[model samples]
Target: MGEELKLLGAWANPFSRRVEIALKIKGVEYEYLDGDIIHNKSALLLEYNPVHKKMPVLVHNGKPIAESLMILEYIDETWKDNPILPRDPYKRAMARFWAKFLDEKCVPALWKYCWSLGEEQENAYEEACGVLKILEGELEDKKFFGGNNLGFVDITANSVGLWIVVIQEAGGFNILTPDKFPRLCKWAEEFRSCPVVKENLPPRDRLYALFKARFEKISGSKDAELASRH
Candidate 1:
């Protein structure tokens, strides 16, 4: 018998989806507890991740693991079947490096570019573009970041595959286009086409509507804050 596995996650969060995808790929059976993190976080979620108080906490047996990347690695280590990380030490290190880079640098820049206005938005767009160029160079002719398999870097870059398009629509901008980022564009298409990725992806319309509301709310708040300051 296997230990009880429970995943506390929210529907719209990409990080939550990332963990879910990993579990699905590894053929792990688990209970999913869905909740609204913005309006009301559940007691279980708070208890598991007291510091971050975030979603996508994986509870195995009685122990809890916080942070999406940490949870991902834990899942890969625990299951051993359909491995997410590479077997080679050097390849594994490279996978980890790219995943961390996407999390720390690219994702932030992309979000900032989508959420901010004026000069801040312009600067963020440039930074995101620079990061995309580097990623494009890395990808080259590879089918995926993990060669033929959907591995660590590919899973971590869930946002780049679909969310970016929804965000671009919501923000009324064009950052990821075929002409500028041909490799990324092709990769996104191929990544999303994968059964594990395609079937599990959040509904595009719902995601668009959610982000549209969020962008409006954020812009309104910023405008109000600026007016009050002046």
Candidate 2:
């Protein structure tokens, strides 16, 4: 029997997209099941990931794996064609470190920066910029966070590359401008240009419209909250 590989994912979620990109890089074929996580969660998605019940759940030969980062590592190990992680233990650990940082630190800050208004937005912008500066330094003269190729850290940082662009444009925030983050902007350009990445990415216009409406809702609520406090 052939390998039974399946991916439970949402089309617009960056986390889900990460797994898709990794699978493409490895030339792995899998069935794509839309979780429709926002409106309605699929039974298979819940069955596979009861704990978090999130998207990008990979089921391989009856085994289910959750979390995009963990799923990416699992794909790399199982396929062993296009290696995503570093061969050296130390390097692999470092790549994990940066990936964690991007998710735990950078992504949240960027979200706040895009979702808030007035003083809160300013504070969030500063916080996000500080995180971007650290990433800029980490990138240095390298072509990618994983050095010459798109690897673990690079894949993990997909939100910074593509999602953040839509978020910024939709929310009218200049938090990740080329003037302040030249390296990151260049890196994002490079990442988006990759053949696998280019093909797998969600339509930019759809993402922009989604984020724009979401940002409007967030800002509207924040405005109401402030008005009530006065």
Candidate 3:
């Protein structure tokens, strides 16, 4: 019997995009279910991921795997032809460690910096920059986070490479600049230009419009709040 594979994802979500890129790299054939998570999440997404009800849920042979990083690890283990995680034991562990760091620390800081208001936003920017600096140092002499190839950590850092650029452009926030993070900027260019990633990314204009509208709403709300306070 053939293996059954399906991926629930949204076009605009970087987390889902990570899974899509990984699957493409491995040459895996799976049904792409547009969860439309921002507007209305699908029933399958809810069924598979009850706790989080989030996207990038990988359903394999009737089994559901939630969380983007976990799904990536699952894909790496299930498909041996094109390895995502490193082969060496220590290297594999380090790859997982860095991926965790990106998910737990970097992603939150970036999101907070982008969406927050006033002093909280300033603090988030500092925290996000600090984490990004750590990532920059981590990339010291390597072409990609996983070394030469777009491996585990590189896939995990998709938000840093792509989404942040779009977010900054849409929201008019200048945080991850070429001058401020030269190496990371270069890495972003390299990552985005890779054929697999380049072809699969959400249209820049679409993402820009989505974030721009959202940022404007937030700004309007903040302005109204401040006006009422006086």
For model 1, give the 10-residue run with minimal summed lDDT: 37-46
TM-score of each: 0.94, 0.94, 0.96
Instruction: Provide the lowest-lDDT 10-residue window in model 3.
Output: 35-44
Off by over 4 Å in 2: 222-230
lDDT (tens digit, per residue) of candidate 1 on 1-230? 76799999988888999999999999989999898969787788889999999988999997999899999999999999999999999999999999999999999888888888888898787898998898899899988998988989999999999999899988788999999999989999999999999877899999999989988998899899999998
The clash numbers for all candidates, in the given order, read 0, 0, 0
Model 1: what TM-score? 0.94
Candidate 3: give its CA RMSD in angstroms.
1.2
Instruction: Please list the C-alpha lDDT of all candidates, in the order they appear.
Output: 0.91, 0.90, 0.91
Candidate 1: where are CA atoms >4 Å away?
222-230
What is the per-residue lDDT of model 2 for residues 143-213, given as tens digits with 9 covering 90 to 100? 99989999999989999999989888898768788999899999999999999999999999999999889
Which candidate gets the maximum TM-score versus the true structure?
Answer: 3
Error of 2 at 134 (Å): 0.5
Q: Which lDDT value does model 3 have at 75?
A: 94
Better candidate number, 1 or 2, judged by lDDT: 1
